[model samples]
Target: MSEQSSQGDDDPGEPLRLSVIVPVWQEAATIQATLQHLASIREAGHQVIVVDGGSDDGTPQLAEPRCDRVLSSGGRGRACQMNAGAEVATGNVLLFLHADTRLPGSTLAALKRFHTSRNAWGRFNVRLSGKRPLFRVIEWFMNRRSWLTGIATGDQALFVRRPVFEALRGFREIPLMEDVELSARLRLVSRPFCVTDPVVTDSRRWEQQGAWRTIFLMWRLRWRYWRGESPESLANAYRSDVRNAQEP
Candidate 1:
């Protein structure tokens, strides 16, 4: 092999080797800000890749400048778009982030530090960006449930080593609950290390839908899903109950 190729083959030890992949659809309002946050971590050998799932809202254009690579997905599903981003990403680790979520400045460095352990596949705790007191209660419950069950939601900023992600064949192509499904599969590899440093996420959904109602809806959906209801069915129910529920 050529010298450059040999050097590239060396494992990334004690350095940031992460790719922040944001799969978006019609996220023009938030994609730019999310990319900007990820841009700050690029100096640590981390890269950002935005996968636009056939967006018509200029999301790709806004992401092109702030992120390292912006690619258009052939389909419009969170799982499919995330897998597409991973296919072209070069980092050893992949972080699947949402367009409405913002990570801290130390996110890349934290991931590198966590990578030193065997359980590198994990997610950060989440904080909702809303003034409602119920948001706090909901976030606490979400974080606690995740820590206890070792199953993480997408809003938590799920991440995993590239090899393990590929081995698990990326996320299942489901209409909803893809993150939960991936976490279940990943449990065979390692229990997710829930980082306490929270990722701040937009609380518009909870606010618009009414926090208590949204919480109950989610619980019902999960219970039905656990009872063998198809993701498509759950997705339909979610859309009927929640405004802008089709969003990724």
Candidate 2:
């Protein structure tokens, strides 16, 4: 949702539309499917952009045919990679999605509906990789927290107008919470709405580490960061393994 700033004052001919940017680093195993899903999203009129952050496993080549534009990223950090993708995107609305995410076909339509319903911007609900009841609890609590606080994450798939994104100068390029930092800014401008449906996110990291331990670490690290812990500290705490079946 936006304040409707003259409906594209700069482009009289182009209607404000959605642009989805997916940042990836060595996600070859999962990138192809992600791109295919993105390609299917075009039927809803959303443009998908992929920014490959020096993936050595031919991830860029795999995404080339499916994405409208596939560009080289500045670094392997998710924040920097996403910012690089945004730099070349032309859509009026930008949605930052994860490589392991599976957004619903109705997502773009829901975006239109939300934008028309209220003057706010937001993210969709989240579903975990497995049907573990515990994981479901995590997802529910996270969604509720986001709805209550307007704080969304990259994995939740954030969508914003390009001009607003540019005005905010995009992501902070930090190793952590690039999504959190960006969401904070979006909340400052407008409340983020939640789509009724959910987007399933891969829990590869959790799988690599023990799920319970990963969850505990995530909660502890998140609290630490919110309490003013440095990004490097959090990065050190984060497990950087990509051993799951879906990750490359």
User: Whose lDDT is greatest here?
Assistant: 1
- TM-score per candidate: 0.91, 0.87
lDDT of each residue in 1-248, candidate 1, tens digit only: 00000011323564547888999999898776777777667765678899988989898898788889999889888999999999999888899999899987667556755566567488888999998788899999999898888889999999998989999899999999999999999977888866777999999988777788889999999999989999999999988886554445
Candidate 2 Cα errors over 4 Å, as ranges:
1-16, 117-120, 240-248
Q: Spell out the clash pairs found in candidate 2.
A: 121-192, 122-193
After superposing all C-alphas onto the true structure, candidate 1 shows an RMSD in angstroms of 6.7
Tens-place lDDT digits, model 2, residues 1-248: 22222121233344547888888889888888888877767766668888988889999998888888888875788888888888878787788899999998777667665445433457888888876677887888888888777888877888886777889898887888778888888788877767758888997766666677777777788798889988887886664432332355
TM-score of 2: 0.87
lDDT of 2 at 55: 86
lDDT against true structure, model 2: 0.77
Worst 10 residues of 2 by lDDT: 1-10
